[model samples]
Target: MNPRTMHSIFLKKKRTMVAIAMLSVGSISAQTFSDFSYKGNDKIYTNNPLKENEFYSPILQGCYPDPSITRKGDDYYLVNSSFSMFPGVPIFTSKDLVNWKQVGHVLDRPSQLKVEKGGVSQGIYAPDIKYNKYNDTFYMITTQIAGGIGNMVVKTKDPAKGWSEVQKLNFDGIDPAIFFDDNGKAYIVHNDAPPKGTEQYNGHRVIKIWDYDLEKDQVVAGSDKIIVNGGVDLSQKPIWIEGPHIYKKAGKYFLMCAEGGTGGNHSEVIFMSDSAKGPFVPATNNPILTQRYFPKDRRDKVDWAGHADLVETPDGKYYGVFLAIRPNEKGRVNHGRETFILPVDWSGKYPVFENGLVPMKPKLKLPEGVKNKTGKDGFFPNGNFTYIDKLTDKNLDFRWIAMRGPRENFITSAKNGVKVNPMETNIKALAPVSALFHRLQHEDFETSVSLDYKPKSEKELAGITCYQSERFNYVFGITKKDKDFYIVLERTEKGESKLIASEKITLSKAIKLQVIGERDEHQFNYSLDGKNFKNLGGPVSGDILSTDVAGGFTGSLIGLYSTSSNDIKP
Candidate 1:
């Protein structure tokens, strides 16, 4: 045979081998995706029954952060920070740690603490709730806005009766956790205020446990001891360690806490010691829970993942509850930090974090005999409305809140609509006195308000709006623009206003304006008469409702607002 013919035969054989290898790789990849059944919405399937040892299942949805759970016999009660939302500290009850129901709110009374000036995202910080069986009292501690280091506590025998007046604690810190030792010695563990030098209000990364005296109302036992200051590594400087809680089992003390910033760097760390007050040692494994090492193929990427609490079942199983943020289409975290649950085990001297980096898909078994309850369809029967008396039973839902602290003189009930009296203050400085707001909980929920607006001056703008943040908002109102009574749609950003829509329309002595939001977007529609409607250009892409983006302690709120500096008589 010729030499050139032999070379051609060898080249063809090499091509055939390469094609076979590529086919084998593609077949294996297809099997991997099929085995997981991975899809959107972070849903996973497993053949095993739900037990107390599975990892990676989101327990709650929406911004349910800083979870504090207390197990009372077979029932468990959990509470999270509500921030500026009226009726703060939402309380949820569960039996098997899977299904939960919002039973009531802890901070609803006026004496709880004023949050109007605290701004949106700054009202309440981390809250710790615990029940003292011997005293039959429920105790909760939370930091008040503008108040210094220490937090305030509220106690009540019955959660239905609500909490009592806020009692300020002596310690200067946030994330206050209460622990009652087996010997009946009550102690408080918390993070200390940041020392000067690092980020102001962001340096002290230590967990201190002190004896708490209920009668004296102060922490007295131990001085602030630095437990784990990022393990003496300056490269990881300014690790903001907060949210400390202690758990003891089998004569070993487990101190769990949050570390790093509360954004993408958030994580949970565990320190163990034989004594409560000790030279605690960080687990050699370290960082029991974190997103930095997340698996490559997980459907959801958790940004902020920390602030956890541990709960025990009646049959002696351990579970850890924490919060994390799941990203959305725009690469933004609109859902905020939601609550999650994972089963844990103690192997050797430290708790082994199973499926720590991979999002756990646990098969949760709902507790027997517990029924899921739906949100109230209408307003409370006894709730007093200012403008419209006798609201539909489903009118007043958890979605509603008053801007600033609500005042009695600002609103009242009437036969036609809810009567809102313009207050003698500017909306920018003073909290919107008569503003009634609710969360845009659903991405495509529409909100419309029909009210009689009597603007006393050009400065007084009264109507409805969909606010994204302090820097961005869209409003529809009847205003005196260029000495003409015109219906207009205004867009305000960083306190600067631009008229998006303006037309000469007859302004009634009283007119109604309506605003509708859809698909996490918004549209401005106005009405001079109750019948005719005009569509304003909208559907802008931005955060329709969020705490992180909107710059408030509460979620995206849609409500009625009236702003005026002049005192108007009703």
Candidate 2:
């Protein structure tokens, strides 16, 4: 489909038909589904109330992307790259591939992550998590950019208990993966820096393989070799040939990597070689899976479907989970890169989606025992009303992320509540400031936080924020202009903060601040008595703070923030 058709399908001017249903199962209710559907990508979402043999689309929603999955016995474990978000590399588990729940994060401790001054989308890159049957250990390999410590690996036998400290690996390029041969030999494959610089072409990259030294925990000397250089078809000059995964299937080594960058032109290519490290040959039909080319009758525009990993169920069926984005009318995506699953049809020369995959499918069947589930404790729909206390132990939940680590000192807890000392820097600064937030998991959700902070100056503000980046965010907090203190709602888009709305009120020692997000707009509210809330004139366009609008790898983070001037003392 063309860009125009994609827009028409989602544009407000076009009266797109929306079908809704209610499905309730037990005490849990289906709270979320795809908002709108196109002609080909029609999705009729229901809060499926019954326990059935079915699964929902976008199985793991929000900005979860670059998925790496492995199956052990009847259980499946998956992990995704958490860029700049603290407690990085969220790991998930599922009996059925369709319904997944977060088990824990690989980098849950403060010492594992160090993205203080890192760029918004600069911390962790694509990570490959695998289970070594020989040693019975789970391993996760990843890269940290923007003053990061480079490539590293962490292992754990029980992911729920947490992972071990980092075993730093030396690699020049990023997007690393580990493959263990059936012979019990371990190998590492990664997207390597170009022997020839990038000016050569757009997707100029190399996939290198190395023999890993398990005892020493490093790559063996002189064992490094380039397997797939410059992607499948070098004549086309592929770019961003990254996210490589090697698998031994049918007695041959299968190598898969995402090419054509990570944007609209994104795609997946496959190569085959006899040896784990060898001169692999590309499949005749190079791009085994891609949404770029479409048949005339197809109507859905699920662009950027790349960065995939393969998994086999107990039944021996294969499936590929990749990343894709659903764009709005303006062709700007706010959802970030979401995970999409497809049946990997292996009947052909190489495995691929038989007829391509849609962004959202109405119904899918899973094994009978596999039931659709959400949340760690229960299914909490994305856009539901849930209040989180400032001092609850849930503050350390996997969903609660920080700008960086070593947070115990700055973010402290008291018997009454959590105390956030203002960092000597604003949110706009590149350096990590004192900030705590939760991912904007829903397109429409209500969030409110209680703040007892009394800002003595403009630099000592503490309240809630709808953050997109350092430059783009909507801050709803209390700041002092002079002797008079006021509750303020400021819109900071494109790095400039302008007072959009304000209300002068007397503080009762504590106040309730709220932000209600409705698709493209957000409303700010405040309550002095905790009973009634006054809308502080919001309806601010939230599209400007989206991934497409702001151009980043992370989605909006809405949570508590406190900032002071760089020179201010705590």
Q: Of the candidates shown, which would achieve the greatest TM-score relative to the real structure?
A: 2
- For candidate 1, write residues 1-570 as lDDT tens digits: 432343345435544653454355331111000000001122222233334443224555555678888877777888888765555777877666765666666776545746666555566778888877767677887776633424778877766556676777777767888877676677788886544464433354656677778776567744556555543233557477888888888888888888876766677888888878766777767678877666544554555677888887887767777887655544444445667777666646766555665564443433344332222332111111122223233224343456555423344333444444455453334353545554433333344566555443465656665554444555666545445565656666665666676666665445545555443455677666667877766555446345455554334545466655521111
TM-score of 2: 0.84
lDDT of 2 at 428: 78
Highest lDDT model number: 2
lDDT of 2: 0.71
Superposed on all Cα atoms, the candidates' RMSDs to the truth, in angstroms, are: 21.5, 12.4
* Model 1 lDDT, residue 194, Cα: 44
Candidate 2 lDDT by residue in tens digits, 345-430: 88665787644543334346665566556433544222122435445451355555677643343455444566556656777788
Residue 223 local lDDT, model 2 = 87
**Count of steric clashes across candidates, in order:** 22, 9
